[model samples]
Target: MQRKIYITIILFLGIVMNAQSGKVGIKTANPKETLDVNGVTYTNSLYLRNPGEPTMTGGSFLATSENALQLYDPNLESSGLFNYLKLSLTGISGAGVTDYDTKIDADKFLIVVHNYSFKMNDGTTNVALDYGDNGTNDNRQGSPDVVAFKSKGTWHIRARFTDSKLIALTSANPGRTYNNFTIDLYLMAYKRLITKQNINDITSDLGGTNGSSKTVNRPSGF
Candidate 1:
């Protein structure tokens, strides 16, 4: 029994001496960190917090102050939510409009026209679209000029003609019917309320001294 007690004291001294070197390893001979464990670890809860921070409990969560991680906070409105959609604008005629059900709230979303493609059902085939011409050339119909807006949870798209009457006189299809017109829209929807007019009216001046920072409230959406 005395020999066994001497062995336990020596083992405890060995562990203390190892820890005094600034790093202690569990199930490992050489440790690279303060508390390196070579084997698996189990714990009921894990938390990360700043030094001297108080422990949190009762449904509380850990959050970081890092800017890269703080850029997106799920607690705020989902302003970063993005959606892509393809819209078929069929039978675009002079002063004609097409309506589509977006299913996204009109007051809480923003839309941007990403790209467009046009097709002709008439005899004309393989006609390249001229993006620079805005209906000024009589020989060519030019790219379709249109305006898109959301109203009452629906998207309203309308065709704008520089001079529909003039194009009708020179176009092969005098009826001014543009068949198979399509557009790709990029939608950014937010769960909170935001208006198109409010975003449009914003003109923030971010110019200032270098490395200067300011604290401000989160935007309406985020």
Candidate 2:
């Protein structure tokens, strides 16, 4: 009986040694990779470092542009939070609203305008205005009060101006014109993959009931 037990141990050790050059599977009979683990794997620490790169910062996830599980590409110029946009307003007269398609889907992405600059030109003259450049008009009709927002699956910038001293220029138009109006926008965007809903009202009664009421009026009332 002792001899049979010794023979069984020797055979098991030999089999393990032979499998060292082949695939090893855990909780599985057939392993597709070198170290295939079919069940959940738990590790105290995980590191994915590039060649010749120093140790990554702790408590933060890091990856390159071509990582296996592509969450975000840190190497991209416009990958993170901030991006830029330049728009030209053409053929717009007087104070009103103008809409531009940002080419960004309203559902999957959320964008916010941080800062902006504008350049207005009439034939040969040009005036540059910053966002907070709402001072009184000098020789030119200063900057218009521009309200930028995103709605209806696009971006809209509405410009309104107060009546100022009339200055001689190209055409007889008050405020700014769309012929040579250009705007530089600094924008921030967030990627979100979820259902979008509009909340008309928000009510909170601590430790009590909560409800919502919303209504829309139309020509054909029902």
Candidate 3:
């Protein structure tokens, strides 16, 4: 009886070890689509911001602060797109300053800057800006599309506006003339390895199959 019990315990231990060592296939998908994980479906918008007063009226407005980097979820789900991340910004409204440009500047916007440096587990960082033509009707739309990077752990993303100005000369010095300007951002998460593999497979499939009707296996865990 003792021998039999020992054998049973060994068999159970082996099964547990194998289960722990199992591998999960990584996958990628358009963030707009619903993500189903472990028999549950999750759908929501992700927004990140630092704690600070809203943009000012005449003087420099503080859209986001350095220590205010935080994720806001209306639905409040358990799991989120924390690993694979994307950053996008859109100007909603603006006024005053003659020339306006937005880029991923590091020095001035210290608190609201996103990670652009290449490093392991940093995942990928992308940026886009929209600027209206000085004279022509054609407005420039900047879409630095999703850039992916690998991250071994969690990362922070943030952004803020700087170099606020006015076109006309004024001695009075308005309090916050750029009160009309407004900006919005969109954030997304994606697994790195799976994302890379997906792109490679897509290019290969396109070249080999010539856009033929084919179904590729989706990444298992993303």
Candidate 4:
């Protein structure tokens, strides 16, 4: 009887231990390229045929232009005007450090920027900002994860990572201890729209555009 009881306890403990363990999520900038997770790298067999082609299982559509590379659902529309394009290499690979039951912190990581350039039309310019935390909690605040530049004409845009570091966990599992690390990246872009009036103003001798007449319309039902 004691032997059976011991066996059951051992099995229960094993189950509990397994249940408490979790995995770290991995996200990549390019899905077609093999990603290195916890020092282990694996390539995706599926490839994207074109910008708007359907994505295979475990793969996603990545839009790359001279200015930027963006990941999107395969069902989304493609931008034919982009100068360059690439795939999104994002995923989860190994165990990551946990925070307060909400987030998992990535380990040390680096961002790689691709050099690209393009011609512009109408002398208009576009710009992108590429910035984010290096899996460190403190680095996330007020940082631009990614940026996109679009102007009237074609322009070259490059993507890259500028910094890295170690910080606190942003999220974690319940009742678990973690010292593990994973790399997480956030991408964002800001666009400044230029209008014909502004262009004229900038080129005007007075450095300002002529003011347009203002008119107000009253409610019709009143």
lDDT of each: 0.48, 0.48, 0.31, 0.31
Q: Write the per-residue lDDT of candidate 2 for residues 85-145, one digit (tens) a residue.
A: 5454543333323455666766656676666544443433344322223333354443455
- Model 1 TM-score, all chains together: 0.36
* lDDT comparison, 2 vs 3, better candidate: 2
For candidate 3, the TM-score is 0.20
- Candidate 1 weakest lDDT stretch, 10 residues: 62-71
For all predictions, the C-alpha RMSD in Å is: 12.0, 13.5, 20.1, 27.5
Residues 139-217 of candidate 1: C-alpha lDDT, one tens digit per residue: 5443356556777765555444343321233354443334433333343343332232354333455568453575445
Candidate 4 local lDDT, 1-222, one digit each (tens): 999999788756654544444422233222232321333334455464454444565465455444344554334534321223332322211222121111111121111224222111222222121124333234233322233333333222222324422222333321222223223323222122111122211222433545444333443332
The alpha-carbon root-mean-square deviation between model 4 and the true structure, to one decimal in Å, is 27.5
lDDT for position 20 in model 2: 83
Candidate 4's TM-score: 0.15
Candidate 2 has its poorest 10 consecutive residues by lDDT at 128-137
Model 3: number of backbone collisions: 26
Best by TM-score: 2
TM per model? 0.36, 0.39, 0.20, 0.15
Q: Provide the lDDT at 211 for model 4.
A: 40
